[model samples]
Target: MENYPKSINASSLNDWYNSEKEDPVLIDVREHSELEIACFPKEFLHIPISKVTSTYVEELFAGLFEREIVVACHAGIRSYNFCQWSLDNNIVSEIWNLEEGIDGWSRYIDPSIPRY
Candidate 1:
């Protein structure tokens, strides 16, 4: 892919999500057990990284257009990798990795979100 993809920190993402006319789709790629400790307050789709398959992705994104997808994980590494994978497969026009992941959100955006 020609594009290197992009990333958004918790602060910028929070602001963009609230100020923008269109809401970006926040997806948590962390394992289910990790969510029990802390979770993003906003509405998001939970899709474990392990279960991500071409078929599942096609079905999940079916009928969706011009969607802004933001992938998140524990510390951002996994999410960043996912972003690369998305781009490699040409899954979406735009995909952003949640830099520092939920841990960043907990540290920078909301302290209420427990950090493991």
Candidate 2:
């Protein structure tokens, strides 16, 4: 099994995105309605936590196992749970949870990303 990072703070994520040669996929697990309140850059893939079901996982995320995935939610709880489940189910080995979630991102990296 591949050893994956468990979590990443917003500032480090910001720095990684800015300087890293390989672009990591940022997956937002917040609901569609929650997105209207605050949103990250367009580069983030909006895949609500609810949609990560078995069928959806098989259909949409099967090929993402080898990719670097950073999952984010409002306060990090949901994303953390998702990443844990993904790891347990062998969905993705390179998955990481955004420490403190978008709320942290708003406070540490970009204040423009509203906090709810």
Candidate 3:
């Protein structure tokens, strides 16, 4: 099994997207304004960090039901914190955070995506 707190880089994430027959849930934890300025692949679900608390995260995650989840933020600090929280709360799910956020992705993988 892969590491529980595994962190994936942009290429790794793209490769996972390419190889997985059924895509996992891609979650962006950025704010709405940030999303308006830039967004990830259309397949992802956007859940702002303001709504990621234990009280409301379940609502955000409703219907996902044990599926693998990839959480991202500006530079992954938020996502990493969220992953740690999920583990602590025993909300067992395969969770990964993009290691460098969209900035790293744009720098190393796809320049077409803007950096904010």
TM-score of each: 0.93, 0.88, 0.85
CA RMSD per model (angstroms)? 1.2, 2.1, 2.7
Off by over 4 Å in 2: 1-5
Which candidate comes out best when scored by lDDT?
A: 1
TM-score, prediction 1 = 0.93
Poorest lDDT segment (10 consecutive residues) of candidate 2: 57-66
Candidates ranked by lDDT, best first? Answer: 1, 2, 3
Q: Candidate 1 or 3, higher lDDT? A: 1
Candidate 2 structure quality by residue, lDDT tens digits, 13-65: 88888885676788899999999999987488888887788667656676665
Model 1 CA lDDT for position 104: 98
Q: Candidate 3: where are CA atoms >4 Å away?
A: 1-4
| Superior by lDDT: candidate 1 or candidate 2 | 1
Clashes of each: 0, 0, 0
**74-103, model 3: which lDDT tens digit per residue?**
888988877777767656555788898877
